[model samples]
Target chain A: MSGPDDMQGDMPEMTPDEILALDLALGALPREERRAAQLRLRSDPAFRALVEGFEADLSPLDATTDPVLPPRSVWEGILAETAPQPVRTAAPVSAPKPSLWNSLALWRGLGFAGTAAAAIALVTAAPQRQPLAPAEVATATPEAPPQMLAASLAGADGTPLLSATWDPLRGTVVITPAAKPEAEAAGTTPELWVIEGDKPPRSLGTIDISGPNAHAISSQRIAGLQPGSTLAISIEPMGGSPTGLPTGPVVATGKLSAI
Target chain B: MHGPVVRAPASPGAAELVQLLGRAADGDAAAFRDFYDRTSAKLFGIILRILPDRGEAEDVLQEVYVTIWRKAAEFDSTRASPVTWAATIARNRSIDRLRARASRPAAPLETAHDVADAAPMADALIDTMRGAASVHAALAALEPRQAAAIRSCYFEGLTYEALAEREGVPVGTLKSWVRRGILRMRAAMAEAGATA
Candidate 1:
């Protein structure tokens, strides 16, 4: 398959180690060779350095290709997969818990049926907190058993900032904000916390103030969702409070109630 | 050897990405989302080039981000820039998918032409990065066949055996071309870094 006069002269010779590193970096090694090279990478610092060097050197090529915005569904899929799953708990003596897929179907089937009742409960429970708009309540399909626990959080000035709903069966909390929270100070972020009587606050993770977000709760933490427990938002350093307790002033607070 | 340059919009600086990754490691989904918004397009570009099929490429993209989330703690800023680290993951995952398939699909026409033409697309598009120009410059300096072999191997994730068959050459010859090209490029990059 060679040309009559292929130009093979003046080519520099590469050591086998260098070849191995190049192949590994390029993802070109056969399966067996790849496994062997990977093992070598862990044990051989010099070989590892070679691979890293090649990877760094070759990385600039990434900038050459035109960036294409992947469809939004890709991000949605990522969120679904990466969202925390309900921690497995032992089956109760009486009845087995439904599988996640089954619960999700049941949840969808009950959609909007209980929203009006839930909104009324939210209004009567906290007069200071702004109620969900009438338009939102008007869209309810019909009365289905209420299956969600909800809270309407407000700032100290009595202005509604956000609302939260906990779906116990799905083990997810959906947070919908009325408006974007004020910009955080440099090096800090707005964190969500669940605080029950006497115990220290548990972080629900940093909240996205710009839009609605859903977070899965583990069964152990789900105990914090009792009717009188409080959900608060506080400003914490980038990742969150290192001490596992709120270190800044509370920006908003609301009480959880079953609707 | 340069092709038409397609400039990417300005992205978050490296330091910001590092910070975002740190927060992500701490389980900050918001920080993770911000990171994804800033970086996904570029990583998707890298994946789509290797995989070609939109569905396959998008699936691989999802897998890559999930990996980034799980492995954010392992990122070492001292070793590589955040973009490079993420890009490496994307490339490796896409290549893994490529290799795992029962039979390699025919190379897409644009990719085949790019390799055959030996056009240094990287040099044209990556001029902003400090040493990028030199890497592509060195690539352009290589013999055309050697350069083609390197590009095919890197961008298409073609193994020596696969590439050799495609080019109607011995696998050893294909490997030789890539190895020689890599050494020259590395040396050129080092020289450029030293001078800079």
Candidate 2:
């Protein structure tokens, strides 16, 4: 029976005219009309493949570029401009240095001095961070300070899809909702995975997705995700894939580039 | 030769970070201060990639942080974390700044194509704030041929056909090299204990 969790590889493909219509539906329309066209085109595999082809053509855009960081005071200048008018112009260079929070991130970066945030947190949180069962491990409390996330893994082509800061030694991997191409976001669950040390990718669970998208994994759950593995996102069903073979198209994929 | 000493400590969670960013958005000078400190250096790195020169990059960096403070309100908490949002602002601002600068008597920017061949996907590619070093380190681990193919495609602005010609391989072979290289890299990272 075609119940839940069954794979549907037998779907029919799209025809040339219909494919063109779908392409036009997406390409030559206002944002509102495009959204409508997307709905119309969803049932057509050929059209979906066409769209997927476009994404394939564009994936190289995600390749990681090496950006050289500048002095900390420069950012101070930027932020100082945001202060009230009087504060903005008058806030002299004697700005109070950010507490450990400011310096915390510097240590986390590869170009900077000091150990990784994660390594530092281990020392402080060792007393509290107890090991747990696998499933429970998925939602463990982080030993690192608050401000760090676990989304800094690289996608395909060694492109980083996340960034981070450190809090009392734990690293933060900045994660955003998987930015789906136009006409995406319907009936798809974007799930994250971590691949460490040749082990098959383990599920890091689903990102919140959409506007309210939240990065799910933090320090407590980071271990289950595995480090140094490529982080990937595959478009699964509403919940996720049961086969674990990346059944749906991969939305974005990156590896864990530890800096 | 000495590199920084290190240990693998734990990382922070996104939920907590959203809250921190939320505070920064609400005029928590401390939060803004901390965010600026944490992200500016990385933002500077991103700026330098596009802008190159030190003075110009610093100027752009300053403008980027200003934009972050003013636009923090527009941030969709779920859409992007503080770092990603900040970095995006920095990157986009840098691109714009670079465009303006180049228009001031340098080579044209809109040469053969406008920006990266694929922008949104490229955003997914180049613009992602996934930790820079870890991802690059993984890329470094790939076979030279495979890595070169991927890098050329992503960074050096080489078309697959162009890459094929340079490598003395068929176009299809070049494509396969990039694809396989990516897959192999993924496989390698999986072995490296990577998590999302």
Clashing pairs in 1: none
lDDT of 2 by residue, A1-259 (tens): 1222112222123344433332231122222222333322323444544443322222222334433445667756655455555354555655643322122111111111100000000101112346778998897654533323233422211122233212324333345532222323467676676555445556767664344343435666465443234555556676777877445544344433222
- Where is the poorest 10-residue window by lDDT in model 2 chain B? B1-10
Q: Which tens-of-lDDT digit does each residue in A1-259 have in candidate 1?
A: 1342234422335566776787889777765465446434433557777777778777776666667677899999788766776334565544633322132121111111010001111221333446768996798544354456778875422234588888877888888875444445678777788766545678887777657888787778776477766777766778988889766545556777766
How close is every model to the real structure, measured as TM-score?
A: 0.55, 0.35
lDDT comparing candidate 2 with the true structure: 0.43
Q: Which ten residues in a row have the lowest lDDT in candidate 2 chain A?
A: A114-123
Alpha-carbon DockQ of candidate 2: 0.11
lDDT of 2 by residue, B1-196 (tens): 1111121221353344455567876778788776665555556655555555667778767766665554455465543444555554554445434322213233232231213222122122222334334445556766677677676544333345555776887765565555544444444444443343
Interface RMSD after interface superposition, each candidate: 15.3, 15.3
